[model samples]
Target: MDLTGTQRAGATPTWYEDALAWACRPVHHTTDISPLRAHAQAVGHTDGYRPHPPHRTRRHP
Candidate 1:
């Protein structure tokens, strides 16, 4: 957690945990509400969102 410590200075950075010797669990992201927030900032399509997800935008037609 502390990058400023002396331990990291002389040695290569290692994984924070050992894979073979330990168990792991997923750390849940608290929120991903950027889309709603962005849409609100763009004022409900009156100003428009400039970039959309790539697959939504184009076709060979």
Candidate 2:
């Protein structure tokens, strides 16, 4: 999926702003193990939760 950040034109849309805010939201570190991460760890025996690798995009001049 193409993130809204790079697709915006003049006068940013509310959805794009919301998505940007969500993406830039502060994250707090804690000892807590999210249920989803815990389940994944339990099933996959991973050391921790890892998100998918970033998507690569091409820039056209």
Candidate 3:
């Protein structure tokens, strides 16, 4: 049978016919949160150690 273009030899749909096919399957996705957590912790630590000035003054005469 000529399966080129819109030609179908049977009653099965295009997707149904390729149910067990892995070539058109969705890929597995994953995200790593360790780096983000480390950055947040570093920022928090720096914020606690730094002292804020009580007043602002012009240094230039």
| Highest TM-score against the true fold, candidate | 2
Give the alpha carbon lDDT tens digit for every residue of 1-61 in model 2. 6546556554455875455444444344533322222114465464533333343356778
Q: List clashing residue pairs in candidate 3.
A: none
Tell me the TM-score of each prediction against the true structure: 0.17, 0.26, 0.15
Error of 1 at 4 (Å): 2.7
- Estimate the TM-score for candidate 1: 0.17
Alpha-carbon RMSD, candidate 1: 16.6
- Superposed model 3: Cα runs more than 4 Å off: 1-7, 14-21, 24-61
**Whole-structure CA lDDT of model 3:** 0.35
Order the candidates by lDDT, highest first — what do you get? 2, 3, 1
lDDT of 1 by residue, 1-61 (tens): 5656666675454543242112222223323322212234554453332232223324677
lDDT of each: 0.34, 0.43, 0.35
